[model samples]
Target: MNPIFKNILAVIVGLFVGSVVNMAIILISSTVIPPPDGADVTTMEGLKASMHLFETKHFIFPFLAHALGTFTGAQATALIAANHKTKLALVIGAFFLLGGIVNVFTLPSHIWYNVTDLVFAYLPMAYLGGKLIKKKKS
Candidate 1:
């Protein structure tokens, strides 16, 4: 297979895998930690309307979902990419980061949650994923 094609495929796979993981976590989050009363988490409008009712506990799963999804996606990319493994991983991170930035504009999350999620979730996890592959190769 061509390296360029493989790399493109890697990115696509990473994005799909990350999205699946993210949605999976999100789907189960409310079951694990119930939302505030009347909080409809089913739609964008519902989430936006209920944002003010959310507590710190409600933020935990979202953070985990973002971090773990990015980490897993980056790792998958690094594993499959023909070359530039770390760079590809960072690409996945950048994609997720962009989404996070979009969420910041669209959602009404708490400042602390925004800061923490933006600072710690995407790139760091992706870097760690790339590093994990590198270490394994050594």
Candidate 2:
């Protein structure tokens, strides 16, 4: 297979894997930590309406979801790409970062949570993921 094609496929795979991880965590988050009373988390409007009721504990899963998703996706990308593994991994991070930024604008949440999620989740995880691959080669 062509290197360019392989790299493209890696990105596609990374995005899919990351999305799956994120959605999976989100799907189970409610079960693991039930939402505040009357906080309907099923829809965007519901989440927005219930945002005020959320506690710090409620934010944990989302942060894990974002971080783990980016980490796994970047790792997968770095593992599969024909070349520029780290760069491809960062691309995955950039993709998730864009989504995180969009989420900030789309939903109202605590500023501290927003800052933390935006600052610490995506790029750092991706870099770690890429770095892990390097360690394995040594």
Candidate 3:
């Protein structure tokens, strides 16, 4: 298998896996809390009511999911030719984890802002996942 192509596949796999991980985390977390008793969850106002709950419990996990996804994606990519899969995965994981930490800082103080941030965050992550997948083999 071509190294580059393997990486590409890894990224695709990462994107799918990462998206699923993220959504699962979101759904499970949201359910445990259940929308604020009677508070609207649609409007920014409603979202704010839930922000503390979300940030408190699952924010880091999302980051972890992103990081792990990235690491996995990169490893998948490197697998095409690289022998040191573990090391490369660690490197990619570190890169991704750092990115996620930075992302946390970008979050608006406003809870409603996340909805806007959400779209911005996910796809780029997929792209980044691809980048990891396509990274040069160690």
Candidate 4:
């Protein structure tokens, strides 16, 4: 198999799996911690408008979702890539980071939440994921 093709496929699968994990966490979180009463969380616009109604606790699941999703994705990429495993993992992290940045700009989250999510969620998790894979391989 072509190394380039394998790397590309790894990235695609990693991103897909990561996104699925992210959505699953969000779905499970909604069940575990229902949104504030009368808060319409069905749409981004609604959620953004209702951000003021949420407490700090409401952000925990989202942070976990982002971090875990990134970690899973990076790990998968590192595991599958034929070469430059860490670089591939970091690429996945960059992708998620871009999404996080866009979410921050589009949504009306608290400054602290935004900072924490953006700083701690994506890249760090991805790096950890890559390291975990490397350690396991060694």
Best by lDDT: 2
lDDT string, candidate 2, 1-27, tens digits: 999999999999999999999999999
lDDT of each: 0.94, 0.94, 0.48, 0.92
- Per-residue C-alpha lDDT of model 1 across residues 1-138, encoded as one tens digit per residue: 999999999999999998899989988998999999999888999999999999999999999999999999999999899999999999999999999999999998999999999989999999999889867876
Q: What are the models' TM-scores? A: 0.97, 0.97, 0.45, 0.97
* Tens-digit lDDT string for candidate 4 (39-108): 8999888998899999888898999999999999999999999988888999999999999999988998
Badly placed stretches (over 4 Å) of model 3 are 42-55, 58-138
lDDT by residue (1-138, candidate 3, tens digit) is 776565456445544554565556555654655544554555666665555545433454444455445544554534542344444444444544555556556443435444433443434443454455455432
**Global local distance difference test of model 4:** 0.92
- What clash count goes with each model? 0, 0, 1, 0
Q: Which residue pairs collide in model 1, if any? A: none
